[model samples]
Target: MRPLDPDDPRSVETAGRAYRVLARIGSGGMGVVYLGRSAGGRAVAIKMVHPEFAADPEFRDRFAREAGLARTVGGGFTAAVIDADPEAEIPWLVTEYLPSVSVRDAVHSSGPLAADAVWDLAAGIAEALVSIHGEGVVHRDLNPANVLLTADGPRVIDFGIARAIEASSVSRPGARAGAAGFMSPEQAAGDAVGTAGDVFSFGSTLVFAATGREPFGEGPWHVRMRRVQSEAPDLDGVEGDLRALIESCMERDPERRPTAAELAERLTGRAGASAEGAGAAGEGGMASLPPAVTAEIARRRTAAENPPVPRPRLEPPAPLAPLPSSPQPWPAGPGRYAPHSTMDPAQARRPRTPLIAAAAFVALLITIGIPGGLWFTVRDTGGGVEAAPSAGPTPTASAAPASPSPTGIRGELTFTIEGSGRVSSLTYMFNGKTTKLTKVRLPWEKTLQIPSWPPRIPWKLSYTCPPGGSSDSVAVDGNVIIRGQGSSGTNMRSEGVL
Candidate 1:
């Protein structure tokens, strides 16, 4: 969470209802989150749209539409949206306050989780996507930061929150909307992102949880995106079933990735309307998490349940002049007090700025050396994204065009290495350049676009591995013209230089 601005409003009122903010929870480029209580005294997280965004007509419409769409999301894995006031001068929405540690922080403080824990985490989040997508909302940016760890299971928060930010022209027009390292290739290219993009992010989050590193080695945002666009994920230590599943989720070809439902089913070992089975298994998912993560969860819960008490702010009283031994009860005349003139009606008619008073009060608390005074701080999910589209100015975050063949290449040059015992070493010579990889995951693939004009160019390939067989093929117009089928432990060397 970013530092709080002491001058921010202490409470927000809308629709004849008011919620008092204790302190700023956090701030983002688009809004400020505050730990507050509703009129009924229920604690909630109030996400207030930044004043600049609230002032934009287009943005208000988008906020209303997006907030309303967000209200439809339900299920245990997601934080519930309690209330919202989009029409208010300063729009705000309320979400259930989650008193738990974030997955990213837990991972950073501890280490990569065990495979069983990763599976539980994946299944729970996948089921969350099932609920979110069912309402026609895409989380757009699904990364570790947005997932909270609790005793029951991981709860995915800030669902569909990014769509509001993405809609504002303020959100860097034409720039890729998601955070670095977790963006899908299409999303990174500023192309329309969809449910498949979320699936890609889910895979990236798994990689983070399993390997404690971005699938695409990180540097600058562009550098990470470039890796996402062309390179296979670095699943160095991650192996076996989870590796294959995560690999599938991050497939460069979005269509080839599994749907949220399929992922839930796969990870939870459920079948026949597995989405339901997935939700059942997700109930006690946190049981698999490492002890460090569990301890963090307990700490957050305890801290939230029992807030720190502030030291009393006391000041020395001013000394008064020696009091008269006997007070005089005289001077009851007109001259004793001067009379005042009537004030202007306009001045009297002016409305009081209660918010200013509230701000001043909050500022006093902070300035007077009260730590976190009544305010509770919580972190926002960044290096991540959430939320989907809705009414007004229609959000710009979208998935790649439905069809890949039209905008994509017609002739596809494909290569694969299946039946894995872990590729200790694998290399490829592509477009005249050669590269090799170590500890490679199985069922690896690389596809190149063959332009229609140059359909007959470079339809040739050859490769050799220690024992595991590697396969390469060239196809034009969806028909396999040349093929090299290599079984396990067999060297495959074939060429079709047509």
Candidate 2:
């Protein structure tokens, strides 16, 4: 038997049979998906509903209806339902696992699909929607993320929020179900949704696949919603028949939009023609996909077959050592330099016989006589005093200034980025404010002067590099030195006091 994934707890089981959860494949508002193997050793994608939602009868009913609808949607483009248990403590459903990457990831990693590949993708998704709508189910959520690109073709997998066309509400009040940029205008406006809403979402998804951006433009949720409801979709880079088809699908009035079956017919160039021979023709048309698309599909398949190894857990760091103590001042004495008059009473009352006698002897020697300007020097050695002859002129004793030294403290904040790509941007956050640094060349070093304050002033530094690279915030205090290493996609960081 294959070993259970240590990273995922094995507390969950479906229908009294244990499924070794290999890893968490995806998650969304409704539930979490896990990559697992059945008792019979079949790979499956298991979606378990959130515990909080399982307690609500309304949500449970909706979940059961979604599973029933999904079971009815049978096609080559849809993942078949393997097993499900909606009445369980945490209702769960399982489907055949497809080793593929989502359309969003494919476009993000390899840029937009070529024109021909976009056509193939559109055809596949439209066909899936046909099978889905035939079962009287509306896939309320159909964004690029829900469409998986596989070697054979694309598959529409996540039906968590799918509801029957006759259902009272798409979702509970105050809760929006679909993605922002792809939701239909009617759906965004909280109006009754229908199969046409999915068609609108399909058109938006195609726009993203063709241009590597959202059709309605990206921003805050309200802005995207406003654009979807009022503004024309930004389809600048889209071209040709596909563009026209997308425009037709995005009609402002739901009644004017064509059905999913009609879209599939149009995409496969079989409009107004018999349904026979359409599948063969569609297959033949997609057989000649662009080399880039083929390579990306192959790459995705390989990745799915061999998912990345989980990183090891890091141990807690050791505690820091304490700082050293400051030095203390020395005691006072008498001679030419007598004890300060402000000395403590206890110390001042102590006898000064030896010191007084020495002072008197020096005074007698100076007064009783000596020739040629004799010189004498007295030094305090902690235990007693010592006298020595001076070779040069005797130095005069001067009083120390009654103030601390006049020195200013300053420091430098140095950032050394050792990546291969050029730095695109850098910013530092301190004292509730953020400061952006000028872009610098690769393998760069820059320094900013910092005025002295407290010994430790907390700071957070962030950096970004060209061609998609970013460093996690490097947090430190006082004078900081940051070192960043690695190429565009994989960067590491280190910090030290300057």
* Top candidate (lDDT): 1
**What clash pairs does model 2 have?**
none
* Residue 201 error, candidate 1, Å: 0.6
Candidate 1 lDDT over residue span 1-498, tens digit each: 212233456688876878877654544434567777788977778888766667667778878887888899998788888889988888899897776677777788888877667777887789899899999998876888778876667778877767766676543244334556788888766688899999999999989998898788855344566687888889899888888888899999889999999887676653122223323533454645678777766765565555433223333233222222222333345677323344369945665454345345434333332222122111223211211121223222122222222132433455544444566666655445567777777556666655422212333344444355544333322222233446555555433321
Runs off by more than 4 Å, candidate 1: 1-5, 270-285, 308-498
Q: CA lDDT of each candidate?
A: 0.63, 0.62
Question: What root-mean-square deviation over C-alphas does model 1 reach?
Answer: 24.1
Query: In every candidate, how many clashes are there?
Result: 8, 0
Worst lDDT run of 10 residues, candidate 1, spans 382-391
Model 2 agreement with the true structure over 1-498: per-residue lDDT tens digits? 122233344435655877666655654445557777788877788877655566667767877778877887877777778777778887888888876767877787778887766777887888889888899888888888789866566788765454421131322233356667888999878688889999999999999988999998854454566798999999898887878999999999999999998988676753222122223323432334445656766664465466555433333233222211221233445434434335578866888776667656544433332234445545554434444444656433222222222233333444444435566666665534567767666555444544333222344555655555532212112111122223464434232221
Each model's TM-score, in the order given?
A: 0.59, 0.56
